[model samples]
Target: MDDGAERIFAALRDVSQSGAPLYLQLKKNIEEAVKRGLIGPGDALPSERDIAAQADISRVTVRKAVQDLVKSGVLVQRHGSGTFVAPRMERVEQSLSRLTSFTEDMARRGMAARSQWLDRGIYTASPDEMMVLGLSASELVSRLSRLRIADETPLAIERATISASVLPDPHEVTSSLYMALGKTGHRPVRAVQRISAVNLGEAEAQLLAVPIGSACLQIERISYLASGKVIEFTKSIYRGDAYDFVAELRLPGPDGQEGEAT
Candidate 1:
């Protein structure tokens, strides 16, 4: 093992005297090391067997700890290659007031964005769909699924559902769904989105070129037009290692700030 790995093992052993679960202890130690700059982003980590030998722990314990780190976005595993520290993600700037598309976002970042159409068709609404999209039983729903790419890297899988009456034809839609909707006078003016974390499954891992059970960002978004019409609802899974969502907070102007409650 290298110097960094040796230090990691020693620190973990020293901090684990309280006898916490081995895997959790290892995780905590590594996180602290990262925070303290002993480990930096994009550093290569020791292999499982190497770490096990260095720490005098079982290989299973090492595996569990490494896998947990991979699932939490702290590490990344490359197929046919070894695991490494995850790259730092650039914060994504989103205007909470406007409905935007992945292509548009990438363009603003000065990267070429692309999408592979997976499945597209019209279907009747299910009970869950009716609640999510505010659709009626008789209304036709269009589902568009795509694998999103930016700068030639696969970044996310997106599925969009909307009223067929709004889109009319699915094939006419291309790169940016928002742009397409704008052309039809049904552009979304506002949206509500919920964000969460998930572990990538085998299929998603294959598509995103990450290890199975890797961390991902799950976002569900519902957009509305000014007429109180539900324009579209979308669910997206973003590669956790490659994306960061950010929100900027501002203090109130001087007088209001002074009167703010603690």
Candidate 2:
């Protein structure tokens, strides 16, 4: 065994005597190694058989321990490749009550945000887009699709649609769509968003560098101007492991007290 594997085996040996279940003990040992930077992210783990033989434990114990870590996002398994530690990802906490662009939010967190444009052009509004944006079938809409990145890490995919009259040219939007709309004096003042959990498809998983069928957050948003006109309709998919949506809640007050819900 190499020095790294030797160190891991030594750590495993130290935990084998603990009263905890063998699998739990093994899991804890691996976690401790990661915490101490003995095994950094993306480091390949020993094969189950090799680990079991060296640790004097059953292969089942190692498998169970590894599977647990995979579910907890500490490890990842590739179909053709061996299991490895998951890449460290920054978990962004987003406030559901606020209307902020992805660029603005990342800027507030001191992270550089950028977008890779997938498609941007004027297109006929689809039936769903027409319904959501309150557009007619004949209306042309500026469609913008992009892969959002923060600090060079892929974070989400966003597709937005707005009336052509509101956004005359989609190509003019080099970065934040909201910023582009601001120049037209049509930036949305408020937006309604619905969030749902989904299993990402193959394409989405590949784009996000995650395993197929990974859990993701699907969000649909309709933004309105001060005049209550639907200004934008957007659909986005975010990596579940990298984002947390937070909302403040308050209990009911006394009678005649007004409380706002966000």
Candidate 3:
């Protein structure tokens, strides 16, 4: 064990005196070491055998602590490789005052953005989609579902729907949906969006590479054209730890009146 590892295990002395469980005490010590920068991201952790031998604790205790850390996004365990501290997640700030596409937003922030298409096709409109898009039962809706990535990090899962009349071919939307809509003269001028807190399910967790039940933001949006026609409906799931929605606020003037935030 390195000196840093020794420092991390030093707190194990008199574990019986600590009110917490032995594994919990060891967990706390490991967290403290991480906070103090004694162990950095991607730094390999000593094996369970080594840790048990050095800390004078059972391997079961060490395993429990490490598993907890992994679930908390503190540590990562590769199949054949040993455990290591997870790399830091970069948080992104998005302006709520502006309606922007993920590609445009990332471009504004100077981060490379890309998408992996999940599902794209013209399908019979579902009841919810028909209601949201103002389509009749006879009409179809183009559906586009994709994983949005920024700087190679999976940031969100976006699924959008549009009336086939407005967007006949989902294939036209290669990158930015707005750009594709603009070409068809159906781009939206404004939108109404609602955001809610949600927990990731099994499939969503796997796609996002985070623990199940991880907190995330769920957003539903309706985009309108200049003529007040609903042109698009979109739902998105964003990683809570990697994004912050910022809305600029101002105090009312002497008249107790406030203008639009923008």
Candidate 4:
């Protein structure tokens, strides 16, 4: 067995006992190794077969233990690559009560934000776009698609559509789309967002440097101006392990008063 397998065995020996399932004991052994600094982030773990042999446990148990760690974000598996300790990432907390751009959100946390543009141009509004943006069949819309990065780590894939009247040239948006719209007095002041969980597909997984089928948060947002005109329609996928969305709630008053406190 290799050094990593040997270490795993040693850790397993230290914690192995009767009564509990072997897989659970192995899982605890791995966690303890990580806590004691025996295994650090990005360190490759022993293969399932190797771990099973060294720990004298069934391969099925080893596999289950590893999979559980993956689901818990304690480990990461790369396609054609062995499992490894997950890289430590700073989780970003986003407030559901604010209408802020991704750039603005990162800026608030003093993190540098950048984008890799994938698509930018005007296209005939699709039926869905037309319905959402209140555009006619003949009207065109500007589309901007990009991979958003924070501190050089890929965080999200964002595709935003705006009325051509609001943004004549998508290419003009070199950084923040909201900033570009502000110049034309079409920046949205409010937005409604719906969030759901999805498994990353191959293309998006590759772009985000995550394994295929990794969990992610998919968000669809419609931004509106003070006049209630839809200014932007956006769809975004954020890394599940790297973001937290928070919302503050207030208790109702004696008379059942609710809504933002005055």
- Every model's TM-score: 0.62, 0.69, 0.70, 0.68
**Which residues of candidate 3, in runs, are more than 4 Å off?**
1-86, 250-262
Candidates by TM-score, descending order = 3, 2, 4, 1
> How many backbone overlaps does candidate 4 show?
0
What is the C-alpha lDDT profile of model 3 across 134-241, one tens digit per residue?
Answer: 888999999999999887567899999999998888998999999999887998999998999999997887566578899999999999999999999999999999
Please give the range of 10 consecutive residues that has the lowest summed lDDT in model 2.
253-262
> Relative to the unseen true structure, what is the C-alpha lDDT of residue 210 in candidate 3, on a scale of 0 to 100?
72
Model 1 Cα lDDT, one tens digit per residue, 1-262? 5787766666666434467988888888777877787777767787788777766778898889888777656777767788776666554555644456888888888988999899888888778778877877898888899999876467899999888988768877878888989998988988888999999998888677677888989999988899987788889998887787775456576666634333
The 10 consecutive residues of candidate 1 with the worst lDDT sum are 253-262
| CA deviation > 4 Å runs, candidate 1 | 1-98, 252-262
In candidate 2, list every pair of residues with a backbone clash.
none
Q: For candidate 3, which ten residues in a row score worst on lDDT?
A: 9-18
TM-score of 4: 0.68
Q: Could you give candidate 2's per-residue lDDT for residues 57-79 as a string of tens digits? A: 99999999998777666777767
- Compare candidates 3 and 4 on lDDT and give the better one: 4
Give the alpha carbon lDDT tens digit for every residue of 1-262 in model 4.
5676566567766535587888888888888888887787878898888788777778899999887777556777767988887777889999999999999999999999999999999999999999999999999999999999987667999999998887888999999999999888888999999999999997897677676799999999999999999989999999997999998898777789975655
Clashing pairs in 4: none
lDDT of 3 at 88: 76
Question: By TM-score, who's the top model here?
Answer: 3
